[model samples]
Target: MALPVGIFALFVLMVLPIPPLLLDIFFVLNIAISVAVLMVALNARQPLDFSSFPSVLLFATLLRLALNVASTRIVLVNGHEGGNAAGEIIESFGQFLVGGNFAVGLFVFCILLIINMIVITKGAGRVSEVSARFVLDALPGKQMAIDADIAAGLITADEARTRRREVTIEADFYGSMDGASKFVKGDAIAALLILGVNIIAGFALGMISHGLSAGEAGELYITLAVGDALVAQVPALLLSIAAAAIVTRVADARDLSGQIGGQFADPRGWLPVALILAAIGMVPAMPQLIFFPAAAIAGALWWTLRQRAARPAPVEQPVEEVSPDRIDIADVSDQTLVTVELGYGLVHLVDKDKGAPLLTRITGIRKQLSRDLGFVLPQFRIRDSLDVGANEYRVLLGGLAIAHGTAKPSRLLAIDTGEVRPGHGLTGEATRDPSFDCPALWIDPAARDHAVSEGFLTVDPSTVIATHANQELLRNSDQLLGPEEVRALVDDLKERAPALIEAIHPDPLGLAALTRIFRALIADGIALAHPQPLLTSLALALQKTQDFDSVIDAVRADMGARLIARICEPGERLKVVTLDAALEGAILGGMVDPGTGQPLIEPDCGSMIAERVNRHIDEAKGPVALIVQPPARRALAALLRQRASRCLVLSINELPARQPVEVVGVIGADNPAHQLPAPTEEVQAA
Candidate 1:
């Protein structure tokens, strides 16, 4: 209601004749509004903080233009009466501001017009145009960065949505600014034209209507004309400056004044300024009095700033006394199961002042892992260590370093996952991705869009570290489970199915046996996220035998379909890489490990088998299973666990009867025999 009423009033001011007293009030109000807007623009930390500035500027321009129309009417109609015939504000500008000289007032008004139209308004308009273009061009890349963060588990869905909204608001604000700048430019031109009309009309009206002499008409009418122009131009200049300030801001955490002051606070900058001023002061033709005093002020500022810079930071005294003989366990050991230690240079990724992006990403990873593994993982501890390289970080499981990688804290990693176009011409520090060993480059953060356009997946330093940690956690998930985790799993299951829990715990299988079986299942790529069916299978398997091996075998055989589902989708034949019949026979009757009495393949044979399986796995580019007899399953699984980790090892009994399988290749066969024909539809036992 207020906005509509104010807009109606602006139209009324332009259409109806305004009294001199009311005109004066409107002039002062316009000037006040312009000043208040300038102050707000200067204090804004970012352009989006003043999102309403464009609309405000439009209304303010209309008000000023309306005031100009009303003031022009009064000046032309009341010129012959006196200088005060129009308004006190205009009279002061004509006499006091320019000293009663119409020529000087005209000169001042023209200079103000030039500054507003050519210097400030022009530059601000150009900046607004460029800013809008760049913002719109980078919109896609910015959205991609948010999506990448979400995919890397650095932020949740809600945070991503908020970031996307902010990006949209920023684009809209700059776009509006680009259009609103024209208002300021047009206002300046309109003021110049109004000045011309006021002077010509007032000059002719005074002579023609009141029969005044040429000199008297010029003196009275021209002075008021220049005064009206100057009055309007003053506020116009202020508004132009305000617009310039708003568009030129660089989105800092501090306001305009604080940002400038902080950048100019360096003592070294002041010292050079003092030297330059002092050198100029010594010249014979220069004004030594002014230059010397300016030099002294600079020198004094430098001295004061240097003293402040040199002051040592205050240190706090310890409040507690400690005995030398006492030893704390926390200082010597880490209680957390997973620990991430970063070098000094990478510590900023975890700094709370910078939003602690690494901490947030790690928390997201933990949540994701807990959901996948079906248990609450222990809290991961992050700390700084001086032993590692400045850019290196290590992931420690149970205080032992399992995986380590280097990251550039100030740059982004653009990974080429075999999709980058040839001759992309990217220049940076060449490196390999630590997580996947893919070709990558450590490029400047500014080149993220270029890299993305070139088909490279660019990720920030925090995302890189979090991804490495996520991969390592999944690989070593079996070790992460313990008695406490197993206990918690059983307790949670008890609440949902107390009868099933009673059948398994403390009777045939105790906590220790249950923990070991769950660990084995997890190691074999069977997740316990759905505990009801898995625990039920284990309870039923226990009724047949108490032998640990037999119990695991029965449970795995019952859950064979679930294990196969992890790798192969339904309605698709599973690709199987198997050993030759002779090779399997030799392995079944091979030398045994004395400790566990399990069949062990010779070293050379094991390496050859691992190499051949890896080749087939790579060629397939999907999950492949190695089918062997029950006795050889353990040995082959252990051999391929490191070399061909993607290959799922399954025994004859563990393979589902109804599941369709394709024998992709056979290891330990000649090159011609390697390309074997597809077998029958059903899976055949090895």
Candidate 2:
């Protein structure tokens, strides 16, 4: 309301006639506003801190233009009345400031105009244009950086949002300033034109209407015209300077003065200044007295700054003191689910000065695994360990060593994947590839091209470690997931399908139960990458049963087609290994767990089944599924989990009806043989 009323008042001044007293008050107010804006611009720590500067500049320019119109009207109508006819402020400028000399006043006004328009306004406009363009061009990169930080867990979602908002505001501020600078440039030009109008119109009206001679009209009208122009030009110059200062500012923690003062406080910069001034003072042609005093002041400043630089920074007080007897939980236990411990010799792989190649590889692995797996993997920790050999690194899961290998930091590993030429001349140490147990040679980096020519795949030491870690992590992904990950998954799903989440969570199932279900699914090779469909399947499964195993079995049956799709493409025959009917029945009835009421196979029988499954897989030379009865599925899956991990075990009901099948081998048969089942309707549907 106040702003609207003030704007209305400005327009009123331009239209309605005002007394000299009121006009004088407006003149003082315009000058005060310009100074206030300049001070605010200088005091701002960053351009965004004074985000309203563009609007302030606009309003101030408008007020000055209005004042010009009111003053011009008064000057032309009353030039014959004398200098005081306009106002005391104008009168003071015309008589005292310029000593009643219109020519001198005109010359002074032109000097100020040239300084404002050509020097300050032009330069500020150019700066604003370039700054706006650069900021807009880098906007996407800034946004991407914030998102990357969020993905790396370096910042939370709220922090990322705040940073994104700040980036948008900064871009907007600079863009506004880019256009606002034109206001200053135009205001300068307008002031010049208005001054011309006053002089030409005042001279003509005085001679024609008031019947005065040319000299009298010139003396009376030109002086008041020059005075009015100077009064308006003073504020215009202040504003142009203000505009320049705002656009030229760089973001800092301190204001402009403090930032400049802090940088100039260095004693090293001052010593050279003092020496240069002293050398100039010794020259005969220079002003000796003035130059000597300037040299002495510079030398004194250098000494004072040197003393300040020599002072030591104060030490901060410790927040808390630890007792010698006290033991902390963090010291005794590792909180991270996954940790990579490097030996002293391998420490250089993770050094930042060396580009942290190992860390970079690990981050890439984490991102890839997060996409393949369902949930975000927790951050992995890297630390130095003395327990391992100098060239060895160990990966730990839940504080237990899961994988350990050695890497030679000074050489590359040339892997022989049955492709290397026989008797190729490559000299290095012989070793086995830790990732796949392939034959490999640790060759010099200089021989990488030769190794490639000999059909050897060359990889650096960091890739070897990172690849090994990735394999181990993928195999143990079930262990990486917890209740927190499940909660996050649920929260994310709730955003898209709240009703679907509401059907299963906190009603028929709790968070712990859902976490266990998800872990079981992941262990069975069902990724949570597409949770909407998986959760929807789970929600439908909950409609029939609430028992943990029953719900899991139901969901697995619902998602049977997706599971089959992961291993075999559409319209392709799936290579399968089935159990002998008699053997499967025997195992299904042999033993039952009292707690789970689930059929369990005897240890010897389980080992025999696992061995046969592994043999069938080797013969097939590709991924094969072991199809069994629903009652015997869990028992066989557990038996072959570690021994024949490559063979996927599925129940009869879990196999999709439309999937084509080829019976590659029959496990537990008298003579193992490959048999293609007839293309009958029943076999095709199974």
Which candidate has the top score in lDDT?
1
Error of 1 at 130 (Å): 35
Q: Provide the overall lDDT of each model, using Cα atoms, as 2-decimal numbers.
A: 0.89, 0.87
Tens digits of lDDT, candidate 2, 261-300: 9999988887788789889989999988988888888889
Candidate 1 segments whose C-alpha is farther than 4 A from its true place: 1-321, 671-686
Off by over 4 Å in 2: 1-33, 51-100, 113-236, 243-253, 257-320, 345-355, 415-433, 436-441, 449-458, 591-621, 670-686
The local lDDT score (0 to 100) that residue 384 gets in candidate 2 is 83
For model 1, the run of ten residues with the poorest summed lDDT:
671-680
* lDDT, model 2, position 598: 80
The CA lDDT at 225 in model 2 is 90
Scored by TM-score, the top model is 2
lDDT of 1 at 468: 95
Q: Extract clashing residue pairs from model 1.
A: none
